[model samples]
Target: MATAEADVPTAALKVERGKKAPQFKGRDRWVFYAMVGIPTGLHVLLVWVPTVGSIFLSFTDWKGIRFSDITWVGLRNYNQIFTVFEKDFFQALINNTVLLVFLFLGPTLFGMFLAYSLDKSIKGTRLYQSVFYTPVVLSLAVVGFMWQSVIYSTENGLATQLFGGGEPVDWLGNQSFLISFGDTYGISKNFAAILIAIAWRHAGYIMVLYLAGLKSVDNSLKEAASIDGANEWQTFRLVTFPTLKPINVVVAVITVIEALRAFDIIFVLNTPRKTEVLSILTTNNLLGEGGGNVGRGSAYATILFLLCLGFVIWYVTNHYKSTEEGAES
Candidate 1:
């Protein structure tokens, strides 16, 4: 009788406690809704709205000024940009592409080299790093002016001293040089000038990025490589490069964007010889460099936007694929 009475009370207490507890299943529902709402609302307002507006403008002949007057021109803008007046469009594309090629090879590779060298103990490392990064802080307008004087000034330009065969040749003004730039330097003066300028600006940034990646590499793997009778080159090849693959991916994406969207430097490089690029070219066309063409400018911008999007998608997809493969292995 005593045991049965004790068991019955214990069961009753358990049931009462269960009933008194609060359910946590739906308690944080408000937090999820709030988070989703804010970002989605902002994206709709900022990105989607502007994108749709630009697309609409592309379909019409709208001078960016005075929205009161706008004409709708279907595919006329795009057709002219690609076919009728292709010189400006194609040339700008080529110049930007050339800059991009150099950017991918020069800064990325050289920066890796510099970072690897600095990975060893060296004197004046901080000073070197500071000096290298100084260019990145300067505005493109300032750099362009400084470099133009150095490259274009026949009497006082540095290129004149080294390359002009005793006198400075107007690097941009001389059509002969542009004609033969490929013959001599394997790239045009516009190509070389922009390549040098961008390298000076971004090389240090790449070095710093690589340095960070280098630091995260496991010290033990390196030591193991060394212990296994591996030389420094072998160790770096086997251990360091593999570790840096992810950093290279980031560097590539940044370099590609910088190359394509680099407007300020090329704009300031406006000489009589070659003052035109896609951004400047399109702007000049819109505002009438020779004659204003608002419809055409929008078309150029549209093309650039699509191209940038395409490359970004390509890089992202490849990056994810590589990551998945690595995970699988």
Candidate 2:
């Protein structure tokens, strides 16, 4: 049989191989190229091109008018941000830092806990998931309006009804310093309120992410861990959590992006005092009344881009390094 197989003609083998493998030609080839090329082209055109343009504009002085009006300023915009408008810049930066910290501590952890709890096939789990994730589906603008009008309203709002005791508490207006730092910057009461609104929506978003991750976790590992006398927490931390590294990475990146780019809800709330984030400052400078300063806006955008890029690079590098170490071990 080996001799007969070896004696098979090369042309016959080639014909058999050709029967199994097909090649794209004409229309199919064009379709395949379109499927890949269009999206890549659009992404480069819409995302990267604008990013490069922003970086270039960050080093120039322009009123966002005629191209001839542009003048190269060589870090002048950055210098002014640090010197002339340092107060606003620092205030926004602090607010952004606070937001990033809060999201990680509050929503991210809470969402993971919720996902774990819901993954146990408990009664009414679907209903609970729907209820928790409902806020995430709503537009942030709509969420802002809903929270402002119904939940946090000074008059007849649920929050005031529950906590005010009698005097109406301005959930979205009062800017009293809750955590003061000298006379320059502080976490204001209104900003804290906005944080709550942000947390409400963000928690649901995070819960969904973690829930999906949990669903994809293997049951056998969990069963084996249980059989080994590991408690729920231990099993999760060791077995389940380890399996969730990809999900963790995604969640971390998303949390960072969300915290850094937080704008819609705050903007919808008309950007309460002391609640200004980098995005808010960027928008105000880029599109503020009276012509607006393109250079300053681009500088703010560049700063934001750098911050986001820095975190992504750090996290990704650490993740890969740890992964390689684990594999080697």
Candidate 3:
């Protein structure tokens, strides 16, 4: 009886397998092919190809004009980046690092504060949110130019007219270093000016992100904390903030990326001498405006890529590990 029952189950399994796999209809199959193949082809053609080419070019002296002009120079480009052109390169690095640090310390925290306030349903809360989020809607180019002409312009900017008492202050042109690190590196006053504009926009973006995260938190948790005699600060620090881990991670990555990819604003600001960062330097070299060093530009891109990749990988791995632990617990 057991053998007969087993044979019956095996026959049913064989029958199920014999029922052919579902096939797409003629139109649906074509649609699927189009949807997948087009995007895959474009990605391979545009992103991957260019990236690989640039990496190869980084090891060679490619003028970026002719294919035949390419000549492999091994690590010479990287060598120059560290030794020969260390002045601007290191300055760019310092500026990027400073920007990253400042954004996190200033804008990210402030935005969270704003989001926390707004989440409490204050009077005219929607209006306040809109006002803060306006800058985020504007492109970096618009933000840069608007600030340049309306606030930073030496002759007639609001700041110049108001602060200088008629005589305009050269906010963007000032190359005075704020904090000097030896003779080679220091924080530029003009870079600080650009950072202000960046922070204005960045704060709004972070506020929106944090606001979303804040809204999703269970109010019951807050009530429970309050019932337990926990104050607002304690509740936030111990209960609320821990729940915002995902948003915090996202904001951290965005801040780092914005600092690294700060081009449009710096570009519109006339690529100021003192305000040059890695992105601007990379473009300057590749386009021949500064030194036409394609190899160096490629190397700079690679370094930036590595920095971003490292942060992303670390964040993703930690996020998943924590998630798995929480599930197991």
Lowest lDDT sum, 10 consecutive residues, model 1, at 20-29
Over 1-329, each residue of candidate 2 has an lDDT whose tens digit, in order, gives 46545544653465446445333434555787888899999999999999998999999998877999999999999999999999889988989999999999998999999999999999999999899999998888888999999989998899999999988988889888889888999888888988888888888888898899999999999999999999998999999999989888888999999989898888989855688899988999866472378898999999999999987897889889989899778
Q: In what order do the candidates fall by TM-score, top score first? A: 3, 2, 1
Q: Please give, for residues 1-329, the per-residue lDDT of candidate 3 as tens digits.
A: 45555556555466555455323445555787888889999999999897776778789987767889889999988899999888988999999999999999999999999999999989999899999999999999999999998999889888888888878789998888978888878998888888899999999899999999999999999999999999999999989999999999999888988888888988888845878888987898866455767788898887777767888798889889999899778
Q: lDDT for every model? A: 0.74, 0.88, 0.86
The per-residue C-alpha lDDT of model 2 at residue 174 equals 88
Worst 10 residues of 2 by lDDT: 18-27
> Once all C-alphas are superposed, what RMSD does model 2 give against the true structure?
6.6
lDDT at 197 for candidate 2?
Answer: 85
Clashes of each: 2, 0, 0
Q: Please give the ranking of all candidate structures by lDDT, highest first, separated by commas.
A: 2, 3, 1
Residue 322 shift from truth in candidate 3, angstroms: 9.1
Name the candidate, 1 or 2, with the larger lDDT value. Answer: 2
